[model samples]
Target: MLILAALLASAAPVPVASHERLSVIANGEKVGSVDAVRDHDHVAIHYDVKNNGRGPTMDETIELGADGLPQRWTLDGKATFGGDVHERLVRDGGTARWTDAMGARTAPARGTALYIGQSASPWALGLYARALLKAPGATLPALPGGRLRLDPLGPATIGGVDYRAFAISGIDLSPDLILLDKDDALFAVLDTGGATVREGHEGEVPALAALATRLTAQRYAALQQRFAHRIDAPVRIRNVRVFDPVTGTRGDPVSVVFADGRITGIQPPDAVASPGEASIDGAGGTLMPGLHDMHAHVSLESALLYLAAGVTSVRDMGNDNAFLPDLVRRIAAGEVAGPRITANGFLEGRSPYSARLGIVADSEAAALDAVRWYAARGYGQVKIYNSMNPAWVPAITREAHRLGMTVTGHIPAFTNADAMIAAGYDEVTHVNQLMLGWVLDPKEDTRTPLRLTAMKRTATLDLATPRVQRTIDRMAAAHIAHDPTAVTLELLMGGRDGAANPAVADYIGHLPIGLQRRRRQAIAPIAGPADAAAYDGAMAKVKQVLKLLHDRGIRLLPGTDDQTGLSVHRELQIYAEAGIPVPEVLRLATLAPEQYMGHDQQLGSIARGKLADFILLPGDPTRDLRELHRIAMVVKDGTLYFPSDIYPAFGVTPFAAAPKLTLPKAMPKAAGAGPAHDAMDEF
Candidate 1:
């Protein structure tokens, strides 16, 4: 049993009732602060984060009971993408209950059950660890669902103060690194840039951030091992309606045979299974190419989730420089079960609003150097970011071209899409980046939420206007590609708390509780009927933009700027709503991107000799776009993964029973096979 050290050394023993502040730093930058007061047994904390990632401005408060139990907790703030997060949890006697966007839920107050809502801070958990020091086991109960475990990694020091390090898991999408003082009070919250340390010690950011990365990576490594499924024998999928993206048609029932990580045969439904092979019954479902999420910032934690959702590949937009390459190798080596990633070096300019991912260059020469750095590492593309100087575009684009890397990115804050296209942008990143050009003033910065808020201007812009037509004509003539990421627009437009998201409407209840609730919050400011109409109309105008581009010869790449899971389906569905047709929507998510990447021959379509990468949908997506959500099994490079097997790790229920497998009895070896399936139903 152990407790944190004494109060923060800098704070010393408080002589009287006082209010103080703690600095919150992320990646070496001061992004937020926390205010707190302590009076005997009662301690109150107020936490706020301003610009760590996407300006999740939060105001959270917690009041603790004398018994070291949480008495009352409340959080009112905005989350990533601007979703309002307002929640409260109260404890009394032997019960604890919470009220959030999903309404009310209850749990026992004792034992492992604690009502730590999604809005609860990691600091709260650190305090809980101190109280449970001599209580019992390492595992503790969590409200809503799941359990949290604290593994003390022993003594460590931060900013000359001795503390104990602990990794908190099962609370977030990933584990977080934290530390407690000698008396078990929350001492630090850590990330890659630095530690959110007690006030005077904010200079210790770099050391803590490096440590956070190592600890987080170690936890994810164990997860990867528990999820990856490997196959030894040839895999045969029988009785499937094969989807051929090239022809935009779902053919009659067929039996597909794959082995040695390649598709070997496509036979009639009546074909007999070969000896020494494993077979799965597709039950006359549509077998289509595994989807591609063209815009992603993937992580080790999200790797298996992407594959589980039938997204077998992605075009990584940007990430931690040292991490992305190693992760790609881990996935490719079958050390982890994640989607194949085509890396894109993310470049941002050194500005106050600059994102802290990838390389941030301050000058044209530095930007060119960053481009070469990515190209030398075989990165597929270089994505420029919002804070970038528009003047550096030509030099950066020239260097990337010389190094054979394609150019794509935000249309820079002060510039328009036309200038970027002429400056050699092979593609644009998001629809808002392009549409804002039509509506925003030259001086309005797209680096802030204004890029999203200004979309309302589209409500009055005529899509048929010559100014708009000229832009469309140039895009068509240049064969410029647009990711659109229409789902991002939808999230900004339609996410009203306590409402169903049409994008994932069918899957709301089936997803993890926290995620299910988050889907209901609005991400942008919609103050009145007028603002709401503008939001709705802006969404409509973008679809018109999508429709016109498709009608013309402009390339449209379907991408999920958010989580690739389920959202990619929403992206394609939005495309279908714009009258692109379901067949083309499927193609956009599959063969189209494969062709753009110049790997169609080896990757996309259901044909002999290509890599065995596809998904089995219980229903036909060509007729009903929503049917894509009914994913049963996913195959990546001939390795089979049942969504039923992978989902539970992330607290999601399996969508369907995986195909029953019959492996050769003698000596079949898979590099990384998951546990045998209990949910499989044999044909």
Candidate 2:
């Protein structure tokens, strides 16, 4: 009986070998593929592996062939197997043995004899026969080429073949085929690891098991279309009141279109829209190119606030490089909303403060290299701060200009504005730069002598003098733009009283608490009596300097060196206070800086092809400058944002009107009500 059983097992009709499909997946997503074969007790799976965004995969496969036999095997997709597999297997036991293609077997002498076959083995034959008798007909869902479908979770029978169903959830491989016998035991599982298994099919295990005999496949081309929109298309605005700051013209209602990120047309309101065009109603609001804060720190939140204020562009005079690139990228990608930014990186000088801001280049070579470093990084310009030696100016300027960057800075001590200008500084900041030419002693020590000398020296270099006129002429001729942050100086020099200026109150409540604290600290020490006269003298000098610059026909751009957010508007107000007409003051904030930066073509005005950066106010600012404080809406790059959304970023509260205070005018007739001197002293 033993001999007969052995012969029958050896001669049993073996099943044919056929290719089995396999899938590989990662993180529950299909990513690779393979072909496999299965035997009764074991299966060998051959698979073509490919990596999808995940790491490499190791998988195995098994399947039944057309000859009704099963084959199975393991596959290490990484192909890292080495050494003697047969030896290792032989050392284990008779139950586990490995053989090479040359028929060399590695196994330890053991109790059971090993049987291996390419077709269905004796164990497989028994299982197959049982499956055939139990199952007759079954089918599986069709799978696309290069894809695999996971068997659903549940009991199933295919062609009389019974399968014990259990889902392999979160399998990071695509499945190509599945196999089971009458015992419902899984014999083979083939997968590519790169196929996706959809949900809601757990109840279809029986159906999938029935079709396991046939291979199903699918192709994955990564679903590339996800929330992507082109921002390059032109946007048009119609029936808008256009403000052309360049020509000082407020044109009638017009239609403007901006495409390819530039203004392409400015036609009458009746113009027709071209193909692929989008239009927005202007609602009779004034349309002007975006405004700019000539000086601003480039904080992410602050940048957004600037945009929310209708500032389409800004010149970041100071910021760390570590954050600039990301900010630039975010702005360009239309991610977080903000205006186009032009960064200067940081100005190099010799003071402690300068070092904190940027490199402190004390020598000519260091200065030259500093300029080159910034220019190389694509900074729009180089700023020279207060402690630079006057001797380093020429080399720094030449190097910067050579690298296609502009040089602008504060006048060094002992150097007048004109001297710095003559030495190649393209621009000078603050009217203080020109103080040397007007001060009697050109020193900070005693205001009495300087004030007396300034008053007496009017004949020598009075702002109206020919020499002063020549200096101004030279600046204009050189196209040097001046950014007099007069408001900052006024606040700094006006002995703390300027902090309470009504204009500042409008935005002071919005300042970040930290900044507000710091600002108070900065001005607190200067508020006392000993320094009072000095502060007053400084304020007087700032005013005189601003007036002188304007009278000389030198271009003036408004900037606020004050607390970043609260000061921009304050600067505009100061410009108005500095004798610049209201309209002109608005122009300085809106267009002058753009022209100074050579960005006028795309940025300075609101017309066709320009960015949609403008503010909407209840009343025209030109008619009543104070109306600027009432920002109704701000449009930046075609997106509208409210000031309320921005104020908190700066730690400021929106402007709230205070109740009006009234006093009795007839009180002066009552002498006993208060002594005039006492009242005057109290005031």
Candidate 3:
């Protein structure tokens, strides 16, 4: 989440004779802009994007050091979720010093070491590209840690202009693909569904976004060919104990046989192996069904990540209508490695604060039309977002139900969970969306950051109050489900500047430096000791609500609205911490979501004739949820994937060794083949 701040002042003029400007488009809508003024080696920038009622507002000043690297850089702004941002970086003589939410540090300026801003403008990518071209080997040692590399791609012609392209990596999990003019100035930053382009070239967004998608898809396809193992013969996972979701216990050691994308047999460990059957010695590890992330926003990177984390299936909460279905088709056809996806149609009311991810409708007929569009495309549900008119929900829900689609989303602005449940929602998307109703006055708009900052009020909320219980009772009465995404709230309310978030502290050291810093920074600003304590208490209150929901028979869906892969592990762990039994927590992450999504018949359990979607772990997750972090192998649709083989692609260290796989006598070769560790350089 790079915090590109969007000022709330008058709109900046489009590119003119005096200054250069770029338009920030999301889902075909121009929601923000970046304006920059340059003079010699000095540049002043004002970057702002207001989408979803909250985006950063930042002013930046930079002085270049002749090498295209910044000699001094300063940024002052409010972050996306309202955290304060006052970051500074300077290179003086032989020393480089910088300060951010993570505090200040000094390191010797050696070679072409570049200081990556924690809250820099998107233009920084262009600067980096220009500088890397001058560095030895087209690479430079980064300031905090690791090294950044630039890979020049072939020139592309967009809107009748030839532009150079490059992919830069070493900051985040995925490389940043950008386009530059002939002069090596950044012309545009392309993404899967949106893009930021020079003011006069707004019409090229669709083409560039498509190019971004194609490039990303090609990369993942190559990875699939390299790492995904599809044996010609059936695979028998021998000497593995199955964790039976129905019985909530580990079963006797068994041999699980699968081929042609279905589980064919579960037999005694000594069962005779067929002539063409492959074998993997699970060494008495626990085999459980692959996990499910009920709330997700999928991309090529996140898709591969989900598979590595043993999440074999996901329900995309919302995404670009054009991009998601095509990605799903590619994954299903085995051209890309990803979890099975069930996409949800997103519907939002047109407003200044509307989220720019999905279809925006301004009237009842338009909202109904959106529902029909999703249903026609086989979308499983429709997610209503903030800025949606409450008056439109009942009609929208009715149409969705008439089309055999489910409804799940935020309690729209100016409304509450009680209203949505009464109107009709199969499930509520986030716990904060529900809890806010109890603490907020009807006049206070939730579309703004107030929805999150007001969590402080939850510290004093009494769950026993009738107003709170009434909403719970209605949900229970209506059989409404909840995707607490408590892990998301934990990150929002409990994060502390300069300390790793407790939600990700266990594995922060294993991630790349950029992500490590991201997880350590706060999302919501805390003004004082009282504010911090209130936020902490708000998190505790969230867990209490989770306990109440579970005890009251309100179904809880394990979902992480935050990270794509690793965060779901923490979601289940949080459930256990919230007093849900470990066995039940495991069920919530596995079987419960499947049953709720109507996928239980073919995907949820380790039964004969079911799809072969499961994982092998050295320890039983039924005993300690942390064992999930050590998954050795994941079997999805009969394809074998070793996490140890894929982790390095994202600059992550392997948590467990891959199991030894033995092919049949005639084949006489190892079945699992993975990319070499050096393959990480390509990312």
Q: Of the candidates shown, which would achieve the greatest TM-score relative to the real structure?
A: 3
TM-score for candidate 1: 0.89
- Expressed as tens digits, the lDDT of each residue in 11-120 for candidate 1 is 22333354556787854678777777766545566667666236665566666554455667788877655656778888775678888866777776652355555665
TM-score of 2: 0.54
Query: Which candidate achieves the best lDDT against the true structure?
Result: 3
Q: Rank all candidate structures by their lDDT, best first, as comma-separated numbers.
A: 3, 1, 2
What is the alpha-carbon lDDT for the whole of candidate 3?
0.86
Error of 3 at 284 (Å): 1.8
lDDT of 2 by residue, 186-258 (tens): 4434222112111232233334422331232111111001111123345566676777676665678887766
Q: For every model shown, what is its TM-score relative to the native structure? A: 0.89, 0.54, 0.95
In model 3, how many backbone clashes occur? 6
Cα miss at 359, model 1 (Å)?
1.4
Model 1 weakest 10-residue run by lDDT: 1-10
Task: Report lDDT (CA) for all predictions.
Answer: 0.77, 0.50, 0.86
**2 or 3, greater by lDDT:** 3
TM-score-wise, the better of 1 and 2 is: 1
